[model samples]
Target: MEINQWLNSAWFWVGIVLFIVIIRDIFIQKSHTITHNFPVVGHIRYWLEQIGPELRQYIVANNREELPFNRQERSWIYASSKNENNLQGFGTDQDFNSPGYIFIKNAMMGYNPPVNHPSKKNPGVLPATKVIGLFHNRKRPFRPYSVINISGMSYGSLSAKAVESLNKGAQLAGCYHNTGEGSLSPYHQFGADVILNIGTAYFGVRELDGTFSMDKLKQKVDENPQLRAIELKLSQGAKPGKGGMLPASKINQEIADIRHIPMGKDAISPAFHAQFSNIPEMVDFIESMATETGLPVGVKSAIGKLEQWEELAAYMAKTGKGPDFITIDGGEGGTGAAPHAFADHVSMPFTFAFAKVYQIFQRHDLTDKIFFIASGKLGFPEKALLAFAMGADSINIAREAMMSIGCIQAQKCHTNHCPTGIATSNKWLQAGIDVTLKSERYYRYHYTLVKEIAEITHACGYEHPCQMTMDDIELSMGDNNRTMTLSKAYGYHKTAIAYEYFNELIDCPHLGGANARNRLSR
Candidate 1:
């Protein structure tokens, strides 16, 4: 018989039947629920809910609001973030066809000012070191503003070129670049005056065997005295309690070594640290790191439940073991690859968090001991002023800076195929980014914006940008009916809180569960 005839025989039919029976026995039979119920294995639903959706919504871009970003806003950031030419036609990609589409006229009443001295001016100067808190008067003794700094950004998530470019920009701008929880990269070493951020993973500075390494941490920081600060990243705005995750594709020899991990596998930072369990214990670890390294230390976090913040604050107040600075990331953070649920459902938007933390610090009267740096969309002159008004000692802008360097605001940061070369890690793509060229825009954006904000402070009748307070102006109506005045809008000045506040009181859903007061009592 031919091949078909042979295969169609009884024995062949029996063989196929046997294979199906075996597969059914092994996999499709039953006990799938049992297999899934194994601790984190069952947590698929939770993970999917937290991060998966936001990522999808942002990537899909169906609606006008960019989900995570608005279309026009994202475009503006991408264009200005990069150091490339701002090339476009008819002003924007916005459709004039739509009835609701609003456009600015060339002869608009306002005089748009040009940047006078983009890179020529001297950097802002104040004191040799920053002093936090002016809570007390000093006929005998009081306090001052602290030289707080920015926290880390993972080298793995960010391109080597991007990180280098940021380092140059930060150094010129007299700020610190954080070496995010993915651990420190050798590239970060070049920007040596960094704040060595020991993220939850303890990725870098770990021994070859995967334990924490004091020698490595010290060696790295000690070598560069400019690496003047340290921050223990407890959590982040994108997904708090959720640690760092590096896909196998992004993990390379350099990353593996810096993070002290094996090759050929994605690195997952455990949600819980092996060393510390509770908030107090976490503080102890940060204190240990700071003491061990002889540098000012702090923790980075997306503010959580109020009980935790109060307990930690109370404990720190009791023990005098608080970190030097508290870097507060509002929930509206994490532009990189993150689960939608985490970004949307879990995180606290920065405006509220920053204000809450400021209140908490004042409540504990710890404002002088610790400083606050606000992240999460801290861009645009207007936005920065708002952050300052909300009591953020320093403001940071990642996506905004990306705009100055010629980003088109694609918001496709997770894809290494970032057309602007601001987010991708591909070697060939990275090679094309000339740090020298990008640095100019970064410098220009920082200087120009600072000046613009300073102008706002002056317009509002203040001394410096830092002096821009809540009592300055009134909120007016939008062209339609959408406007909130300054005094009535931003919690009504630093000392005047119209409502109750807590740093860690996050409502995963706006509907609410735990109240801020409840958390404090707990």
Candidate 2:
């Protein structure tokens, strides 16, 4: 009687129907070779493959084995953001003998600040040693409160909540936030100072014919009081010599409105700017923008061929009409999406690229006239210090900042299905992010990073990071346990002007650096 009832049950019938449907679909699916060949068993294989990354992240991969960012790196960022103890118990697991390993040469006596100094009380209070645009004398020249700032990330590239959290956190952390080439959105107005990045598309300041519109640019500058400077992006590290693309799936009404583009179509930026064809014309364009807005103008690019850079530096030295700052993006930099070849092989890495550019400007005696900002994988203390020693006045962080605000390195940024709600436009995915909570995390992460960098600066016997020279670092040569000083390795030599501002800060007690210290004391 029990067997007869089980055979007639609806549950059994439903299972039978499901099995038949799955088997039929597997055999008939020509799109997937495995599914067609192996039928039902192949379904299991596909499911496991779909979750392979997660399996490796949580179980299979060792702490140092992961690419882009290792498990150890992610843990440090997570702990810092959560305000938890970030100290490691055992000695470093790093293979000290490996090539490319960096070692900081500590001083016999670390820098000791005055007993009454504010930095002595809160190490995170360290400020930039020099004022941006002071040499150029922009009408609105100001010192960036923190040497570390958020990097360019467009509104369309990030979810609304992510943008809101980053801007709000920038305000809390006393760092500037860059509004990337996708254009400014309401989410970026959360009390943070803004650096508007103008890409080849000129999304925010473009005419109907896709040409530069000076009137529109002026309007944007006038409308935003917190707007500090303008960055003209020639190319980013991720895909140098290529344009950016925003897929149609990520485009919403708000994005369309902000970018001034039509809906239901991919937004493509031109590979080259329509405003200027050559370096001289580019310089003139930068000057015009600065004059129009009374703000500092800068250029950002990834290193490629050397002739253009040499020409730019020579022209700037001869004419004195170049950008107030220059940002060098490393080839290792991240992006929402890019072609594999360009991302892997197009431009030079940050360390090499920056050295070359710095040397060029140094030869021309133009290093001091412009601020040098570096962006790559420089969020950590040692890396940031290396950048500073390499002549970087300030450093910008993007992927690390994203991790602070809940990115899991899922690498699904281009798919519009980001598990962490950071790089997605879907409402359901976005709901996972809590603006208030993530903003605080970002603040903590920024504060802790700056504080740690200050600690490293003191350890190297320097009161300010700008005082660090290439002589303070050594890199392993990966042979016979050999090591070489950065100065010897890269032939890097800092010009007299490189230390001019730091010397002035030391001599003048009423300067901006001292004033910042006084403000912190109060």
Candidate 3:
């Protein structure tokens, strides 16, 4: 009776209070929970990025003793930028007797060496013209450059500062800079040479409904005297035989304005050209564009099938409608953004496709008339030499150039947060890239690297880098499957030089000594 009476009094109220306290502890909130120590606003990532370069050298950077595109590439950039000796002070880290690496090609005892220059039957390539070459008439056609020119990289894909820097650098080097599938921004106009890429997304020069505008393209060409080449990007090497799409989240007002695209809509670039299906149609497209503007029109492809190449070649020959050059990109080539599968495994490797395409041109007797430009990881002198040796008239290097100017190649070019300011769609990040400092570095990198390529040409028993031929290259069994020279290998081949040396007359100019031949141009 006493307990029941107590339950209805102060004791019951105390019990309820205790129960409320227990419920709060278990379900409502916990005062003792752990919390991560961070700066105000949780800026750990940003702060980390602020010190990323230093931390990376100590942590994630993979070291290299003798590999190309390794620590050596970085070291070379540093040394060249400061005008210091690029060679390490220490003795060679490489194996002196290693036959696995092909270093140089040497001559046999009293071997009568013959002069081997690059192909002479090249198309007329005027550095400047009145109109965009692609829209010009083909009757008395402009000379086709070797099918390879720098592939598309728009100011939007990269920073405006970065694009202007690259275009200026390309102008200095007498090569072409592709305005990536991005719309031609105002800054890209500063360069002396520019090739506008019309991407599937049809950015920049597109209509309100997202169709291509020839009139806008012509106007762009007329406005920018640097606009000399036009490339129709049907498909890329990294994502061949596939369509292209960009998320709406990636599209901003700047991109929309440059690309002539509406905001808040998914960006789509269909895999195949809506207006072109067969080779004949592709030719007509090229011819029509050439007629529309007086500039070189070309196609950049990542070869998907052998039959397709054969058919395309046959059609071009049959209709007498040929693209000035064919830029055959390797599947392993780099890109700002693409599906992982296509970048890694979808298309033919450069070695395989390079040989096939070279053979195709030779077979059709179009080798001399149509130029071949090879792209895909060709940023270094050795890699570029390899492409030239594989029958490329010229080659383009993109990522390597990025590397020379402090890009860590985090493969985050698709992201606007690129720490180096090389590739980003954002302007604040673009401010990080100082054009003056970067452009001079670009000049140094080009001169030094091209000089190194000329050295390789000389080591291969040639006068100029352009004088190098495929027969001059030999594959090694090790590290790079390295292609090298006879002197570097120690074991020389007489059979390799037998036909050239034995068949040629000693006094002939065609059999001139390597040094007596053409000058290596700057």
Question: lDDT of each prediction vs. the true structure?
Answer: 0.59, 0.85, 0.61
Prediction-by-prediction clash tally: 40, 0, 31
Q: What would the per-residue lDDT of candidate 1 be over residues 1-522, giving only the tens digit for each residue?
A: 689997979998988876665565456646555333443333455667666645655665653555455755655444544433434566655544443232211122333323532112332311111232212111111011112223466777778887777767655544456677776676665442466677766887787566788888878766665555677777788788776667889888888887889998878787667778887778777666766776667677787677778888788777777677778888876645567788777857886677666676677767645656778876665666666666666765666666655555556777677776767778877777788777655665665555555555555654444554565433444345444545465454564322111121222211111121222232
Q: Candidate 2's residue-wise lDDT over 101-211, tens digit each?
A: 999998999998779666777666655666667777778765666789999999989999999999999877767899999888999998777899999999978875578
Tens-place lDDT digits, model 3, residues 334-372: 655777776778888776677777677666666655656
TM-score of each: 0.69, 0.94, 0.72
lDDT of 2 at 451: 89
Off by over 4 Å in 2: 2-4, 8-27, 496-522
TM-score winner between candidates 2 and 3: 2
Model 1 spans with C-alpha error above 4 angstroms: 1-129, 132-151, 473-522
Q: What's the residue-level lDDT of 377 in candidate 2?
A: 90
lDDT of 2: 0.85
lDDT of 1 at 56: 56
